[model samples]
Structure formats: structure tokens, C-alpha cells
Target: MAFMKEFHDLEIQLEDIRSATNNFGDENIIGIGGFGKVYRGSITHSHSKRQIMAAFKRLDRRYGQGDPEFLKEIMMLSRYKHEHLISLLGFCKDDGEKILVYEYASHGSLDRHLSSTSLTWRQRLNICLAAARGISYLHDPNGTQQRVLHRDIKSSNILLDDNLNA
Candidate 1:
């Protein structure tokens, strides 16, 4: 509960997230994993009214981990920022539902592009180095302060942005 204060600005209202994701409709689903399904959505800024793309990860009621794990992830992610890591925009926890909103990676995960012939040798190397830098950032002693270990390190978990940098 104390960590909540650290990310007060990142707490999103359930209703707003619901509206953004079309009530968590299946058609909007972009990915699925052990944790839950991810839906592509857009949120309109209150002041600018500009729509910002976001990926909504709704915790699966049947197989998803408990709220403690969810909060732990939020806390860790909110406290850290890295170019190779997915950006946690906000979170929603209301009425027994839990969801995490993240910056939308248009290119999706690294696994999706492994088979592409367009991937030059240099591009492949860039991806690998980017992922390594991200891991190193988590392990950095002076930077992050805490030695974070990434339990899930797989091609599927390495997301790529629009530029396909990593």
C-alpha cells in the first residue's frame, strides 16, 4: 500500500480503461500469455484530447497470478525506466478486476520477427544488444540500486517499438 504513493500519477480509473479497451473485447486482443490477455487500446488525454495508444493487460481470472504479484510488478516497473523495457503507463484495480496499461509496441514481440527474411545481420545484432543492455540496466548496482533479476527472458517477451530497434 505504501508503494501506491510512489505511482499516484500512474493510477488509472477502471472506467476510463474500460472505455479505452472496449470493455476488454476479444476482438481487441493483441497477445496472450500465462499472466493474461493483452488488448490494443487508445486513451484520450484529458487536456490535449490526443489519443495515446496503449496495451491493456487484463489479468486472467482463471490462470492469472494474485494481486500481490501484480502490485509487485507495477511497483518495480514504475520505479524503473529503460529504452529496451516496455513502458508501464498506468494500472487499474477495481471491482476485483486488475489490469496494466503499457505503451503500445506496434511491432509486437521479437519472436514475431525471427522468421522474417528482412532481418539483416545488423538488425539482429541490434536486437540482441538492446535486450542485453536492458538486462544489464536491471542488474546495474549504482543505477537501479536494486539488483533486479528478470525471470522471463524470452523472444516472446522482448517487445519491439515502431522503429524496430529492439
Candidate 2:
């Protein structure tokens, strides 16, 4: 139990170090939430030139649950790897700031399009279709016998690419 406790503390320390090392400029932050603030970051892994946008969630340092919850979400999200799901590129914690990085959608989110009254009906339907397909892909019906339920499906979570497609 002591060993486990030490390991957990070490992990938290490492996360803090990582988060602190990364720049937390206002320009880096893309969105804000009750639990954390997400930032836009570039990740070049193993020299692969992949242009991807990711959101980094920087947790509130005052909350002890931040790191654990962030880690838990990362683990679960990683296991839920799917094209439909926004990928977790990386994470870090700096002095209680737990940041989660994810792929960025160029066209922003479904909410952006909906907020505007100018969208044609056809465009809205197409967006809905793409979002549905993304959802179906995440369900992974072939592997899991248990039905997958999306407890928090929202327009803002639906990402759009540069091509104006979901």
C-alpha cells in the first residue's frame, strides 16, 4: 500500500512538471470550462509530420480531484479509441494544472454552425449524418456485446474539419 501510494504521488508530480513545462499563454487556450481550461497545441510525434489540432485541458490547481479525474478520463478515452471519438494526443500536470490534449477541428464545432441562422437545411442534415456516423463508429458494435451509451452528446463536442464536413 505504501508503494502504491508513493507511485501515485510520483505520477501526480510528473504531471505537474509536464504541465508547467508547456506554455500556458492565453493564446494557447482555446476553450474554458468549469473543471478545466483547454489549450491549442502542436504535437510532433516520432518525426511524423501530421497537422492536427488538439485541446489541452488545464485543471484547476485548487481541486485535488483534478489530476485523478483527468487521468481517469484519459485512460477511459484512450481505451475508447475510435475515428469518431476525438483522440487524446497527450496530457500533463504542472503544479496542479492537469492538461489534456486532443485533435483540433478546423471548422470548429457543431454549435458554431447551429448558432448561425444562415445554414441551409441540407447542410444541417449532412452535418447530422456525419455526426451520427461518427457516433456509430464509436459504438463499436462488433467488439462489445454490451450496448454503449453516450451520456453527454452535445453540439460543441461534434467537430468539423476544414472541408466543412463533420
lDDT by residue (tens digit), candidate 1, 54-156: 9998898677587887898798887788888788888888888888889899999999999999988898999999999999988884754688988889999
- Candidate that would win on lDDT: 1
- For candidate 1, report its TM-score: 0.91
TM-score of 2: 0.70
- Report residue 109 deviation for candidate 2 (angstroms): 1.9
Q: Each model's RMSD to truth, in Å?
A: 1.9, 5.1
All candidates' lDDT scores? 0.86, 0.62
Q: List the residue pairs that clash in candidate 2.
A: 15-93, 16-93, 16-94, 53-104, 54-102, 57-100
- Model 1 regions more than 4 Å off: 45-49, 141-143
**Candidate 2 residue-wise lDDT, 80-124, digit = tens:** 655556766655554545666666777777887896787788888
* C-alpha RMSD between model 2 and the true structure: 5.1
Lowest lDDT sum, 10 consecutive residues, model 2, at 3-12
Cα RMSD of predicted structure 1: 1.9
